[model samples]
Target chain A: MITHSNVWRFFTKPLMKTRLAPRRGLNGLAGKDIGDRQSRIIFTVLGFTALTALLLIVLFLFLEGTALFIHPAEDGSRVGLGDFILGSFWYPGYTPPEFGILPLMAASLSVTVLSACLSIPLGMGTALYLSSVAGPRVREWGKPVIELLAAMPSVVLGLVGMMVIAPFMQEWWDVPSGLNMLNASVMLALMAIPTIASIADDALESVPRDLLEASYALGATPLQTLMRTRLPCALSGVGAGIILGLTRAMGETMVVLMCAGGAAQLSFSPLDAVRPMTSTIAAEMGETAVGSSHYSALFAIGITLFLMTFAFNLLASFIAGRYSQKGYQAA
Target chain B: MVNDPNAVEVKTLNFFYGEKQALKNINLDIKRNEITALIGPSGCGKSTFLRLLNRMNDLIAGVRLEGKILLNGMDIYAPEAESADIRRRVGMVFQKPNPFPKSIFNNVAYGPMLHGIKNKHGLNRIVESSLRAAALWEEVKDDLHKSALSLSGGQQQRLCLARALAMEPEVLLMDEPTSALDPISTSKIEELVMDLKNSYTVIIVTHNMQQAARISDKTCFFYMGELIESGATDQIFTLPQQRQTENYITGRFG
Candidate 1:
């Protein structure tokens, strides 16, 4: 009849029935309880989907990377593990190609270390200014701009390094080639600054306000308070930020590939042109024949890069976890 | 100045948070070596008034102050007055215990070290004396290197007190120092405050009416950014002048 009471009963009747009947199989699917359970299952699957994909990719990398040890070179000689890792030269096209990645590893380490040197000071200073020194008006406008720097495409940065910075460095320093380790490092540092500064700013801001107040109440000046209380309290988080920045610098491909001159040699000077692991893989993988030893070697480089980043991520979380407990207790 | 009996003198002090006034036309005299308690309901500006003494309010943005605050007969807010020097002479303890995330010994030694007492023996003596003064030396003497964060809440609050005492300030300000503690800790701090009057002048802000009556010599009642009534604690509790003060004290209404 579509009366008012009939409509009201129609809405509440299912709920009332579900409450009384409790376990009517199939009918229970209509109840809110079943909907909640379904949504929970769906969310759990969605959460784990990325993790499953990661595991699959890691397994594939391991299989292909390990194939380099068993697969023979063009002349039918298999590369030993020690020789592949520690061999001084990486001329993969000579009579019996040398596949030692030491030069590549050396290039990777130098660029990352140099980038760290440049980025740490600039990043930490920016963080300090943003978190403590800047007024609210400055901070409100400044923070988003700094964060936006992180979103810039690595390829665009690489172009800038190759086109603009390369000529500048060659003219300024009078080096033979503008494309060198230092140029790559400088561009990498530029890439890493946003990551380091934003994370460090968050770390500094997260320091409990009471600690600063305590320091001030004890007659310490603002600089003294920052040095003694706030910095010490935020040390672990700041450390995590630095490590994350270094990891990004280490893993970066386009900037180093474009700026590092594609030379595969180990040299102590920052002026030397070099090819890091990622660039080596990126530059040579397209030319290598499928299922060949060079193909496996490139995959092997990928595995090394993956393991290094994984270890750094673990260390970052460990530092963040261990010291955060002490801060909680102090507060 | 030396003959002045009051540890602190306030005249027509008004405090504002941007356009909003937090403390209005406050006038009060805090006597030397006596406990003065500021009592009020939540958000009544007791804590704000306490923070003004050490210029801790300077840290906040959009805050303004008018009128004069004299600490030991010297104008604390004068253009030439260094806030660090004023803070050196006046120490503060907060509601929640906040110890530096360092060793217990380092926590107590922090203030002295800041003041440039660099010798090992000098630091050791001051840390020991301050800890003893705060009544925490006996429990923590053996474990001086232990992290201050590992201490119980009461011990942590006492460590904070010891940290402030290490600077040897002439006056100490406490903002509801025992509000976050258990009953036993509250009584312990109450006893410590009584003993502290012999050595240092103290001004405290508290929400606990009974705590004020039990520990304070002089009591000032605050309401809606105004100092409603202030007098000897006994008189303020037993005999009432203002209706609002009487109602607040009797628990009829806040």
Candidate 2:
């Protein structure tokens, strides 16, 4: 005795019930139907705009940096690309200026390597303590304090390095000045620690609780459990954290510019005043005349910085991918 | 049933989690080298009492226990008794299959390694004998280096059993060891548990009444934080002394 209307009601009744809820809408339509399309369109447009802006910036850097090799200098002399790149001295303002970037590249590489060595151990230790050993009360107060340190202005850290650390080093080590390669490295390491520690803490916290319980049930002491089980499980995240800290240290400008003593020299000793690529560009960009060789060289230094950071990010992703795969298969 | 020398004796045991009481005065004597099954509904504190044998509940915050749990006539709750030592002597298998994310060989070797067994040949012997004891050696002997997680759920559970056995514990505490497996796997584990009783004392918590009746020499029924009754398995299953025990066995209520 079923009729056509009864068949329709059977199909539509559940839909109608869902639509009739006041939370949906008074008009018996789902809330998502109201303005959802408009918001979707707006967000898509905003995302596209941001991506296009980033692409344009990279394009502009390439265009400006290559202008040096493409045209003659203002003095009507063609600068040899090899000499300009491989020569060690940088004397842009002197007559018959030499524009080799080797010294700048060396300084930048040495500072970054030294800073990484200083930060990785300290940051990872702090992260382990926060994730495993700290009580809940200590974690509640400690995490925000570390994050706040990250948010502080880099310029303030630079000023502190220049004023306080520089003088201390001068007295402690009998160095000529506190503003040297070592000073810049210390400042950069300080800035990088928060980035590494916070990310590593998150990674350690996400390790499965069951693994820890199994270790304990097997009669492993707490220290043995932490060292053998939890640390290995969270290693991928720790690798990622180390890379992020390295990225921060490599590209930091204000700290190195203010504390690196502004001498573009290639030296083996960490106590010597040395200029990194970031500091070089920051120091000379304002004084270099437009459409000049010096300006183009600065842009070229920018290109080098971009490539190095890009390589670092690629390395980080590689490490993350390899370890995470192992983690997944094992877990 | 009570004539066998007691392997574990509990005297007026009471347990609490913060302000909530989880177990009442629980008194029982598990016989030496025999299988004792604890059967109850959900949240009946059967698993809590099982963990109390090895002090597994010590990891939880705000947990308090009163009375005595004696293992081999030694008071295990004595302040001088280390939890690590107790755990080594009384191994456990969780309700879920919890093989470590390691090779099958390494998973079995982990317990012995923690106790200072380092020679490669020694570890190999321990791993082989333990897996054989758990009846999983033939299936996994060729793939000892394979990851433990790659195994099926039932096999993984047996691997966990083998891992615990590697430590050569005096007693094995199983918490719903077969609940998460298929019927075939459950029967296999049941047989293995029966075989284990010849060498090690076995205490298990199970929700399956049939499993309790089939394998356990002694059965203890718990309800609402209390040990309602315990006796020979045949007597408890066929002729219950308590009305509540009869009601539960007859399916009147959980």
Candidate 3:
């Protein structure tokens, strides 16, 4: 056997080499039976480009937003963003860039708070009616109408706010017969209704039917069941819905621009004219020159809006996740 | 302990879901303080019949009933009768265990809470005693604040039993209470059901032939939404008169 290793090796070499002929047919493919390398490269390039598009958008916003704080013209000094944030008078570039943000905050928060108060109860009630009390046919008809309100354009919302809510507030509440926080808040509530109703309704519907039946079996009235069981169980989703609505109200531009009374005055009176951060950004951005403190300030406003909405959306997602987890346990 | 002519009285009971008939001409007399088992095949209306004890059928849509179901000798289906009040006296445990997403303490105390018992000590007492009766207190007494969902399937089923018991209802309706459970859980539920008959009237619906044999005193065999035969559990299992019921019971056919 030892001797055959060396003697037969020479004879077997030709048979092993010539048994299968080498072929070079698949020139562009990775292997004779496999796909080409260009396909994978093309796919990877496409995927990276798609991801970078989103990344570039966020990066661009952040980059432009940095100028909102960096005022290179004023002695090449960095502008203190806090002054714009805290200052109550927000008349940007009117001789010195009046950067009082408190008035704008008051305007924004007043509208947002008032709108939330108006919508939460109404929307939660509507949600309860649709999810727990209403018949299937009624629910089917009611849900789409509520969602349609959400699908409406913000400009259309602004137009309606100007036409409807402003006059109504003036006539009924005896508001100062002008654009005010109350008018804008009313419009915001209208805009928020769909978001609140749809999510709250989903939350309520997500509650286990057997739990409702169990409550009913335990002699709980429909009202009692809704108040005690369904409401608590659906509180998470309801909270998420409320937060989503709040973010919408806070970041709402056109409605507040038109109806919130664009006055940079710090006051709690819903009847008085108000200027919100979003309105300030929208009104000042077009006329201001690039690299001007006012221009960067607008981007700064955009950043503030972005951060605020991002925080609210994160909170909403957290709450919604918890609510759905509760539902999962019940399910 | 309702001192009346009969605990439950049904006369000319006919129930239908759309065009499909569920219960046909069911006239039943459910005696007080006894376990009555309603045995049938799948979709044979045993659970449907159980739901009528307290008008639980009111939850279902398009469920038509042409009959009267009475409890404690009162005409329960009368125009003035309150289904909610009737349900309060008739606690139900479903086929699948469904506990609230609350603590075990709260789960046991929920029924009493609904009836306006707000005293903390009272609720605690009720919760403790109900869980004790259901044989779940020892396993859960250390962590009553924990969510009921953390318990195993058997424990959750027991917790549901405790929940029902907390109400101190006169009549208890169980719809396949142990079908979703393992053999051990099934035995535990059977024991609880047997123990409960000392004070409460128990009505159960089961597809398991052996369960009907073991737990029920009076057994009602239903077929195709009609009551085929009803007798003592001994007679029904040992010597059923109706051929279909005999065929159903003696492993011949469902």
Candidate 4:
């Protein structure tokens, strides 16, 4: 060592050069040989089973539903759903069988509108209060309890609406007897609240704590920080909640059947009797005889309902996606 | 935020997080318009001490304070003190750059707007000037509306400085303002700190010994949350009075 060190002082030292290639592992599996032809057989069978089931459903819906498009077999086929969807009446089987859908459509639209108005604000407020204002101890356990309400069976919910909500709404408003659109919409809204609350609360909880801390350090009060920093940041999530709650309200069936009187007329009022699609489908699905014009007409209503919901679902999917993308586009 | 608009005096100050004491009993004085650097090893309480200056540690749960932390000889840990005002006057730049997920203009405007500076044009002017003072305006003037998070780490740290500066605090506290940054960013912040001392008293907590030697007029060496040495920078580096300080300075021990 000493000899080498002394020798290095005689002239400038040469630079040492080193090169090493990285070790490669068998991480790329592209060249690997396949095994077990039976695995492919199992996978194919499973895949085709699911595909067959889905295709069968689509085929059933198309053939049975599109049956209305073509004339019914023999005797009296009646006008296609052209008259059924657009006509402003719906008395399926009376001396004069009125089957215009405008009145029923109007009634359903009003009930849904009323329910959305009632549910969204209440759900949003509760969610905000729960997620932001409530302390950790409460929110830690309260979230699951709130969400459990959404999972209650529709039949059970309908029973509760009849036994508890209907009488309460009647007593609270001091307006009258019998089931009506007002009762049904209000009850449906109660059913939708949990969906709104859970989604909106999650949205609020997602707001960054650093943002809140920055606002606080700048001397913004709690309320001001919540409004400017947290709430606006969570707006898209809250919007999602409302959309979910609206879906629940729109698609709800048994509760509407139990509470909303199956009378089709556009009354421009929450108190008046009404008939929504779900209730119509439920109330008369059994009473109408097999293969009767009324039975076929009910099927026509089913087709109309399926299409309407399909469009609503599509719109909801689009709007929610749009908001989510725009909401996080800040960076 | 301005340290009661007077110099701060500390006597036997100590701090804790829950049961674990983070800062041992220590006495220090930070004078006006001077840059004071706190140099120490990791977990030696430099950053903890810096947070104590603005009462930023109050936000963490179960933090306890003992002895006196006085600004203008008024006890800041008193029952009546407003933490909001203290933090506003004693603006902090954290270790990692934490520019808000907002536009550059919005980040700078945040503090003034919080304090109710409502005139739109005036707020805009303050944002521009603060960004300029932080040396970020020239780089970002073309796109003030761009998200603050879009900036590189150096630019983001400078944006944080701009945010703190917008509040017009008299004392600026930085906790490892460049440790998370590259060498160029570290040097830029060092230069900025030097320029900043002309108008504001600055307290910096850093692990970089060279930074303490370069920019600080006064340097405090902390070991295990205790102030082992405090003096003029050159004197402390050249001739630390304590054995621990000398050992630490000579790389014998942290």
Choose the strongest candidate by TM-score.
1
lDDT of 3 at A78: 49
Across B135-242, the per-residue lDDT of candidate 3 in tens digits comes to 999999998887888899999999988898898887899999999999998999999899999988999999898998999989999999899899899999998899
Question: Which parts of model 3 are misplaced by more than 4 Å?
Answer: A1-51, A75-78, A167-177, A323-331, B1-5
Evaluate fnat for each of the predicted models and list the values in order.
0.64, 0.38, 0.45, 0.29
How should the candidates be ordered by DockQ, best one leading? Answer: 1, 3, 2, 4
Single out the weakest 10-residue window by summed lDDT for candidate 2 chain A: A28-37
Chain A vs. native, model 4, TM-score: 0.79
Deviating ranges (above 4 Å) for candidate 2: A1-37, A75-86, A328-331, B1-4
- Name model 4 segments beyond 4 Å from true: A1-59, A72-86, A94-99, A171-178, A287-331, B1-6, B72-74, B252-254
The true-versus-predicted C-alpha distance at residue A317 of model 3, in Å, is: 2.0
Q: lDDT tens digits, residues A103-206, model 2?
A: 99898889988998888998998898998889999999899999888997999999999999999999999988889999999999999999999999998898
Please, what are the lDDT tens digits per residue for candidate 3 over residues A1-331?
A: 5588866764555445444545555552443322333345557999999999988977877888777565453445445767767866676646555665778777788889999999998888889889878999999899999998899888887888788777787888776665888778888998998999999999889888988888888878888888878888888878988998899889989989988889889887878888888998888778988877777667777777788789889998897787556543432
> Against the true structure, whose DockQ is highest?
1
What would the per-residue lDDT of candidate 4 be over residues A1-331, giving only the tens digit for each residue?
6687666642222112111323234642232212223345557899999999988866665665455446543345454566777877776665446667777778777878898888988898889889778887888888888888888887887787678767787788776744778788888888889999988889888987877767776666678778877877777777777877877787788888888877788677776778887788778878977665666666766677767777776776676676555433352
Model 4, range B1-254, lDDT digits (tens) per residue? 55444467778988889999988999988888888999978889888888888887877878998988777566777899888878788788888887776788888998898888999999989998899889989999998887776789999999989999999886788988999999998899889989999888898998888889999989999989898889999998998899888887788866
lDDT of 1 by residue, A175-283 (tens): 9899999999999999899999999999899888998999999889989998888888888889899999999999999999999998999888998899999999999
DockQ per candidate, 2 decimals: 0.55, 0.40, 0.42, 0.23
TM-score winner between 1 and 2, please give it: 1
Q: Each candidate: what lDDT?
A: 0.91, 0.89, 0.84, 0.79
Give the DockQ (C-alpha) for candidate 1.
0.55
Model 3: fraction of native contacts: 0.45
Worst 10 residues of 2 chain B by lDDT: B1-10
